[model samples]
Target: MGLFGSRGRRRDIPNNPALLAAAAENPGGSVAEIDPAYIDDPNGYVPQEAIRGSWLVDSGGKLTGEYEENPRHGVPQDDFSRLTDPDHWLGWLGDDPAAAVRKGIEESLRAQVADAVVEWVKILDAPRFLTGGRRHTEDEQVMLVTRAGLAAAFALSVRSTQHGRSTLLGVFSWVAAHLSEPQGRKDRTWFDLGVGLDWAGERLGERIYELDGTGGTVER
Candidate 1:
């Protein structure tokens, strides 16, 4: 017996009266009934690349936050002054820490040269840092150098992953000319780069590469 006192029969009814009323208003047909208001003009469609800024709006139709600019529209340049500013890096760090490290090195090199683009960015090796006589597992001392156009060097001490972003512990840069043979300095630059080159030669080196005709390097 069912609730309606019928034997072996069930009633198809909505518990909410409002739903029943709403269903009654809809026409019973194979094709779905769509509201004419939903048909939008095709010219209003905006492509992802064309969008530059976006503003946050609340449900009450009120402006919420400031306009945020799209970082992908231009060259990915890190603000030197805000390097240690954690807030600036929020969500900007890509998933791969190694790629971020390589970009940091390449950008630093690229900034120093004119009409020259940095390519074949690689992290030869990353040795862990020592803090107060104790090994800090998170920190890495990265040494990188550039060869073409001009010899530029950069040493980055970074936290591989800190609060979902790579924190820059320190950055050091110099021209390799100061350490070359005639200067009578320890030519350790070549030694360091030699090891990295040897390691890169053995494997398929994953590094930054420039697009065929575009002035910018491929992002990721």
Candidate 2:
């Protein structure tokens, strides 16, 4: 026999009046029970794209078609100019690290500046950072900080040897500077950094995995 009664039989009714009163009070409220078959539908509703138009649509209602082809607008000119200028894309060290390191403390300063610039770029793109739909429009400051930060990160990453104290200090100093910046405190910046770091780490891990596999086995 079970605690209540027999296995097949219904349990004995509760003898305690207080327990019965509590049970009566605890009646299940209105619950719209959904059919299991309704949830089992394979062709369920799926959300569609929220935005339909092209990203390049201008405020003037003009499409960005042939905009790249127009030299008069300076779009093509800017693109070509950037392509011609290798220095624009390449970081601080460029093709030469010896020269950058020889520059000494200035290199560290430049790294801090580079980190600030990266933060600034991310801030510019972020909507939450904007005040009344307007971002910080100080172009000169933006350019200056960006250049400095880029130079610093590049110098530290390339010139600083792994086992050296000075190298570690330089790298940490750059990170500190990045964190000290106003935009760096923002959640968005941290989120972006996390994403970037994860991606870079993943790529490096994949490369290491490949190298380890190659190091282990040789096919006949």
Candidate 3:
């Protein structure tokens, strides 16, 4: 049983009992029963993209506090601030204690960003429009241009040993950027492979990509 009883998923409606009661009249109703008095147009549906964006941004903000502020990690909030500050660059570590701590922090934050990206857009890998394999390939291509990876791409902007410049961040940035845009199915370049790569070039700069190719981004 789910939160809405035996239904496989909850209807996308507000939590108001009156609204739910009115919506229950439809076979799979969500806000269809919403009172006309409260809405400008009775036919309008909520934009799910907005909801997804809110969740992702909110999750990012939470990461700043939830994991970053825990005293046990030995990573000071000020240190974390310096690490995430846009003016600084992120790097990799092999055996240093500080490196390990920063690595853990970076890995956690990257996962949070990646998870948010995945949730933001439910990718449709099926062969829609007869694009076949290209449709599935599209999602893979889009995952490549994470801006965090670009920031860590050995640029001259700002440098640091903090793991903030990991490739995961880059992936997050790309997905977020795509979701951030108001694109429609009619937009020919919306999911174009070249467009995604071009965005990557702009975000990543030319150097880091020359060093780190697109081979490992899709892996765990």
Candidate 4:
């Protein structure tokens, strides 16, 4: 009995007992890893590596909890602040930063589907970071941070007319990979992040959430 009542193989998230427990009553998809470097500090500081917990998606394709069993630090206090030094992004943007970003997106898509074919895919924008602003909102506890504030937080959204499937770890792992690939041809002189997908117009699935490289989604 999967999310949409479609029978599929049972999958598990390795070393994530917390995530496993959370998915106990639901169908499973791909298992993405949680990166410790992307978590925020107790003082509301967004470091080069600041992201916390895993975003839970239920069998019904609804957004659920956004934290782990025990949080490493408290929620961020300020809505605007320097996430990290700009120089930190130099190492991430390699000879082909844009392609790297694409690879990360493909990785996330692969994580969700095991046997199902993607058919076609689309992204709203290239990968870039959210420098400073109330991106996560004052009430939201998930304070997304990247290397030198070089990237923004993203969530994986899958839409289908039929339901009953759960993407195990969401897109946490996909977001982690993008941290090393900024928006640039072959330089790190600038810092920004962007990654989004929508398959609604096709009619097989509709856009439940839009990816604008910013804002909140079911994953990331």
Q: List per-prediction Cα lDDT, in the order shown.
A: 0.26, 0.23, 0.25, 0.31
- lDDT of candidate 2 vs native? 0.23
In what order do the candidates fall by TM-score, top score first?
4, 1, 3, 2
lDDT of 3 by residue, 97-155 (tens): 23443343344344445432111111111111101011235475553323222211110
Tell how far residue 200 is off in model 3, in angstroms: 4.9
Task: Indicate which candidate wins on lDDT.
Answer: 4
Can you write out model 2's per-residue Cα lDDT over 151-197, one digit (the tens) per residue?
A: 12111112223321111111111111222244642211111221333
Order of models, best lDDT first: 4, 1, 3, 2
TM-scores for all candidates: the values are 0.19, 0.13, 0.17, 0.21
Winning model by TM-score? 4
Whole-model lDDT, model 1? 0.26
lDDT per residue as tens, model 1, 75-168: 2223232222222221222364345445546555445443334322322122211111112346535221111011122222221122221212
Runs of candidate 1 with Cα error greater than 4 angstroms are: 1-94, 130-220
Which regions of candidate 2 fall more than 4 Å away from where they truly are? 1-88, 91-98, 106-167, 172-220
Which residue window of length 10 is worst by lDDT in model 1?
Answer: 143-152
Global fold similarity of model 2 (TM-score): 0.13
> Which residue segments of model 3 deviate by more than 4 Å?
1-201, 207-220
Provide the lowest-lDDT 10-residue window in model 4. 200-209
What's the number of clashes in each of the models? 0, 8, 3, 16
Q: Give the TM-score of candidate 1.
A: 0.19
Q: Which of candidates 1 and 2 is the stronger one according to TM-score?
A: 1
